[model samples]
Target: MKRRNFIYLTGVGAAAAMLPAIPVFGKEISPEQALEHIDPAAKKIMSDVALNAARSKGATYTDVRIGRYLNQYVVTREDKVENIVNTESYGIGIRVISNGSWGFAATDKLDKDSIAKAAELAVTIAKENARLLREPVKLAPQKGYGEVSWKAPIEKNTFEVPVKEKVDLLLAVNDAALKGGADYINSILFAVNEQKYFASTDGSYIDQDIHRIWPTFFITKIDKESGKFETRNALSAPTGKGYEYLNARPEDKIQTASGTLYKGRYDMLEDAKQAARQVGEKMKAKSVEPGKYDLVLDPSHLWLTIHESCGHPTELDRVLGYEANYAGTSFLTLDKWESKKFNYGSKEVNITADKTEVGSLGAVGYDDEGVKCGKWDIIKDGILVNYQAIRDQAHILGLNASQGCCYADNWSSVQFQRMANISLQPGKVKLSIADQIKNVEKGIYIVGDGSFSIDQQRYNFQFGGQLYYEIKAGKIVGMLKDVAYQANTQEFWNSCVAICDQSDYRLGGSFFDGKGQPGQVSAVSHGSATTRFNKVNVINTARKI
Candidate 1:
């Protein structure tokens, strides 16, 4: 998390350099050594040593996090593998509240002597910072569970699976695209396992093992005569699962008019074939006539919308301007939340912030600060109900406990408020994706996430998609090209006319949701059903460009 020089993704492309564009950094480790678990008893002794040092140094409160972070990425283009990276970062981070100020320090050294040194340094920094403090930090009381543990519900550890298996799968995906007529293809598989141990002076010792996976690709087709090209991205979603997620199962597949949908499990090869065909069709799709029309949005597309428009804005830190350094402040200002009557959407709109939903990227038994995870409504009956908060911010909301949303992307990074799995609750009425599509008139049906733009305040926005179909008089007429929708956050959600029933609910996620000034990336998810929004303005992105 503290890399001074690191490469960021320039953009998505099916045809680019022969090698992969991004790099993974952490302590280096071989693939075979990746999934080894840390010893909890050893971690507890380290925690005690650090705690004694901090208390001896006049620190009143302290918490220690010992973590081993592991990540593997496999990249391939066409027939050959481009890059296979395996990274591991191991360290201890200590945070302390002394002299009415908060300070943090981390070190890769795991010995008692080194950890004690880090602990003392944290207290020293806190005392120095106390000189400029105007008010003492106010942390809500927490009840330690004594000693506890949690692990991601995964049947097969992707890290334990042979590297050859991952490589073979990605290569097969690329070959399927080529056989389906894609001019070029690039595929990637990313996996992560976080082994963490948390202990605090408040009397808690918590150990957790977490896992996450993402398999994605970009496929392109070019019309040589016109020298114009189009691209389609794989519809596979990142999930909090294991290698089993890569396995294809008929029971877990949802086949709809939008093509094949997946839940719990995914079929990368099948999806690649669909991506090849779709990108080809995209090249010949009709150009849209820009105007206001209803929009039928698949969960894949709507999830990003929810993440930007609702999830970011409702974060208590963002609304309070604590996150203004990078992601900017919120449009749903604190005053609006206090009113508790601000209409954020229609009566059909019910958004939630959940840290306990199984198979969700943000799902955890307890957050980093040792608060138990739970769920709460963010928007209910179309009204702003709550903002995501941690122990320090809970007082502002007159809450007795933290909302349990605090997190740190790595051991060396200090934990802070991060977005949980923010989702739009499914409609109570019995409605299906097909049923929702049948009601749209003169609209565009969109699938898969694409380019998006939003104001610093998370208000006005524009979004695109991987595939678009013209919907006329309750029927999908034909594929459309060069389409994007423009709307304000509140206006768009208020325009929600319908949301499909729970049966249609599905998840969409991001592996790199970046926030804060120094910047840390967290994986989170957004769940939704096929939803209909009325009379949203459509634009021709190609014409504008």
Candidate 2:
């Protein structure tokens, strides 16, 4: 339920009003402060206390996580800065398996006495919950890797940048949108840093520091005569990098008449200007005719589709009905995967789940449960080959090792299975975006994510985008307005006619992908080249409110 508004920000002033009643969650460290509260010295001492307590409580298994999460957001609309927020959340989450049942508890107190108590309580809860269990949890064998550490390869710490610098950049982006013809503009910059430490009875201690950034804006244009309005969003991607992601490196730039799209780097001002101009065209563009048309999807537009239709559906927990109360159960079921012949898509579609991609938002050295992360195929050459699974879910798939896709959004939440960076592999041969467009005789080209809706099962869906262009006889003519594409998940992916080669690959992502009962959010990226889907259903959505 995240909206593009500054009203949701409770940082500094009102944040305390939102926190659940709990003991000291962690040290209150500002964004400008060092990430020292969860240092190895403190983590080791604290972890040892919890581990010893759990083992003494007759628990067969236990794991603990100490975390410090920091976030800063700069938001602006039109000519003024709407809000600038800096906030932090820190806590410890403890999980234990007793009587072959899992139980979890979390507390903000970082002291040995508090953490040990939490651990013992978790074991007691696990024992109690085991009473009605029909089947005991079967965990796949895991090896303890002793102590290990990993850090995001960021050139600069976004938190280290001055607040004024970020505010000025966003204001400039809004100004560019206004000058470029947008009647209204709203821009935002989101930055996050997660300092996490995990320890378990498996004899492993893991430490990881991760960072992510996203710069986005919305520009609107109004047609005075008809009083109709249109909006376009910035095509910049959210990446697992630092402020350097916005540095606008020449190598990361992709130029076109529609404007510039970024890969590894982003130019906020240039994109805002592009969105402004695009929105104006959309206001003047012809309304689309309801019909079947080929859709040439840029990564910016296709990522959300992949994230929803592919990533969510393939989650093992969703398929097993564990998340049915929150996110609906998956259409992809055991019957589909056990057959090993389920065609999830066309041969051009090779969706893989990865946590090791260097620049991906989901990239992590290890999952919260201390399982080492790696890459695996979800849909290999159109076949439903594998599904994302954690240690507890791996035995169900007849696998001996976890997929290492487990995660917790914050320190206070228990670790659970989450989606990895699921993406479409590019074509084997060399292909360009231009050449792919030339092959489409009558189609639509869509860029940037917009309004979208999918069914509870992640099957049927309708998606809209920021920019739309009509392709006629192998060329892009003028822009089109009031356009959206609807399709079934399997039908859409199976319609993938061709995929552009690696040179055209790029990324698009979301800063807040929501799931779970209490509703935790995680950031993730999807990568693909220019992909073509034949004869997708397109509809016009131009009704006035």
Candidate 3:
């Protein structure tokens, strides 16, 4: 039995006390209440037909995932010019296993006929693939769940905000950057609100809502004499929130907040100009020599390092080669699960996979398979400890239950194992970025993520950053251009000599993270503190190119 279900079934009172907001097992929900948000009749028909269809088809395992996604986009070049785009999509995907092979099918139309056809197609595909099956599927055991509903934290729905207002905000930011001496400026802001419902044969049902937003702007400076261009961007973190995010002023009062926050009335434009000047300086900065050097990496750049090296490789499915075609395989093979000490970093390096973090893009109360999300360690005391797993993957690994990592982007995409918010646990000392740098005699300080390349095995990699600064004699000298750092996964982490405390941590992420055979996109966040690596190779990107 799953620990949660066991707790609920054995001690209802304790469970209720533990989760006061969650509905107890066998609790009745009126049809009227359920119908207010979703179509009860349609849901019941779809669930019943999926179960019967899977059983009649002689499939060993099957599940149905339904997703509804709504998205809005607003773009602006400068001034009052703007463009707005909106979309709504929903569909159902059926996944089945037969004769030790897997198959999937999806359809946008949700009716009895379509649902049945999808299920039949899924089983048929599985049967065809079964002929070439190599190894039989083994699922980790999990307690069956009947029904569950979860809502991600959000203040207001982005859709509820007016379209014109969103555009105006983008224009305002563009104007701000342009006024700051930017020869050209471009800006875009968008939001995605998704509603997902899932049901499986093993008696699991889940309903969840997730929200995400990305607001970005770029300012380009041109040298009239040399025709050289330099670009800078505002660092606005993505969040699981609504339109209120755009107007989140620490202290201000305005009835019509549209386009007001981004306006250059405060320090926003000044900061943009400063960043642009820095970028311009970089165009003439000296190239860094390739050699072993001490370095300080800000959270912006460190996030991607952690993503490629730690996040993808730690996925149980990717390590097992189930996700080889899309996201690539992992170096952390199954044999190293518990025995291998994956020397990730110094003793201060602790990492975790969490889906319950508030305001995180990957934050979900319950995963697609109705598994309650929580925290689990990926690395503890510089040693590899666990891998991110979905229900089926967990079963194969002999885990009694999943860590709630299963997810699908939309109804059409089959649920594949996905990433949560993989984060580095902070150090004990409250060391600031300055403090870490003060300790370095000669090094570089890197900020913001740039282009990156990694091997298919995710072992060797090189990463560039948006901003680079030279540290000479324990102090920042100036900016540096064409900078990139290269290191092997183990070698890089092993070189970690220092790390900042929790106070220096920040969250970073990608809006469209791709994975799976047919291609599915998910949004995930990575949070980390500023960190320092010792005796790492730094190269001039211009020379390498």
Candidate 4:
């Protein structure tokens, strides 16, 4: 069993307590020091040392990854600055295949001697562990792009942004919440930059600079006399961009009956103000009656469902039972995929996994395994068509190349198959959010992610949302609280009755998604338009909890 904090962070809400401590491999750095970048030519020289050493040490294949990961966090509660963190991790990890087995070693020491020693050790370990191999590792063929570089299309690097600017923004957000009658409020701004260089015997030299940022907050309102409280979380999605993501524009805001939803850019201050007002409404909202009702799920609310039920179950490793740590094996067995007749969802459900999507957390030019990244379909016309796979497992599906879903949280962690940007494709038909909702006579509209529970097999599940509104007679009637819906994986997807077109599509993502035996966290985005699911199960969570 994986004995660690498996709960990943979406926003600073209930799961905040379970946030895992980020393992630091290097010394803490100042804000200015975080902006320092290593020259790719210098990294190439060091990488050549390891690759040559491994080849001389009798390794058939080898790869070297030199990484410098930087992070900055600004946190505040109410009007006080709680904490600020700036850290950097720099290291080199070598992976080698020898005697038909794989082995790995990592070190923070970047000198030529250290790199060579690590490479030799990796080969020695691989030879020694060859006895335990069930069969030779069957790696699919991948053409190397000689000396290529990729960088996230960020307008401004977050590390370059002034620390005081971030602090002020978060403080203002908290102030807005407090002034709006919130009993308590906490806000945070987190940013990351990954400077990575990869070299392999496949004759590929890749340099990549990746950036990601998330701005979030939590607000609570307490009715002191009744000893009851309500909470609201930020509706911002983490994106693979720089500080520019927080620069919201007028067109970026989507006006909804429930409130304002952000698209590409986010208005953090406005969101905090709306959250404060909404929390007050939540405190006065009526409890939802337990019964079947059509569910109108916004992208913010549906992303978590897609991540847990659709994304996790389709990982090639999970389907084959090789991955069973944080979450168990999939209900989507290999037989079902091979048959090509498994109805994973309704015809309205067409899911695609894209690693090259702009502004997505998983966007990358090339995967860790030196394979070019692109998009592929996971569910087409309601059938299980494909899965997220890496270089080693591509042959299982008769694939020529990997889907580029491989990632490692840190230099010390081994690269593995991780989810890409798994998204529910927008409907081809031009359907607006209003049109989709008007057709639902008796329904509940859910916005923003909330508490979620899924079984080990990724089948049975229950999900709650941050905001719930009752819909009657083709119109929103009032707010409802204590709302949760339960469903099986197959049953829920088949109930997908309608989906909005591209105009309403948006993204919601997790900045920290945990997986693997040693447990490495990867950030991924899930995109979708507003969708409606027909009559299903609704429960009163107030009575249960």
Clashing pairs counted in every model: 0, 2, 3, 0
Error of 3 at 279 (Å): 3.1
List model 3 lDDT by residue over 115-144, tens digit each: 888888888999999898878776665555
In model 2, where do residues sit more than 4 Å from their true spots? 1-29, 34-37
Which pairs clash (backbone N, Cα, C closer than 3 Å) in model 3? 139-395, 140-395, 140-396
lDDT of 1 by residue, 387-466 (tens): 99998899999999999999998788899999999999999999988787788778999999988999989999999998
Q: Which ten residues in a row have the lowest lDDT in candidate 3?
A: 1-10
Ranking by TM-score: 1, 4, 2, 3
Give TM-scores for every candidate, taking all chains together and pairing residue i with residue i.
Answer: 0.97, 0.94, 0.85, 0.96
lDDT of 2 by residue, 1-545 (tens): 11111235321222122211111222344555644455687787888899899889988998989887777777777788876666667778889999999988888878788998999999999999999889998998999988889999999999889888998998889888888888777777888888999999998889899999988776667777876677777788889999998888888887754567887888888888777777777877898988999999989999999999999999999999999998999999999999999999998889999998987899899999999999999998899999999999999999999999999988777789999999999999888778878898999999888789999899999999978889999899989988899999999999998998988888788777888977677889999998999999999988856
Worst 10 residues of 1 by lDDT: 3-12
lDDT of 4 by residue, 1-545 (tens): 11132222233544244233543335668998887768899999999999999999999999888889887878787788877878888888899999889989988888999989999999999998898998988888888789999999999988888888998999999999999988788788888898888899999999999999989888888888977888898999999988999999999988988989999999999999999999999999999999999999999999999999999999999998887766699999999999999999999999999999999999999888888899999999999999999989999999988888889887877798999999999988999878877998999999999989999889999999999999998899999999999999999999998999998999899987888877778999999999999998999999544
Candidate 2: residue pairs that collide:
24-108, 25-108
Best-fitting candidate, scored by TM-score: 1
Per the 3 Å backbone cut-off, how many clashing residue pairs does candidate 2 have? 2
Report the lDDT of model 1 for residue 38: 68
lDDT of 1 at 181: 94
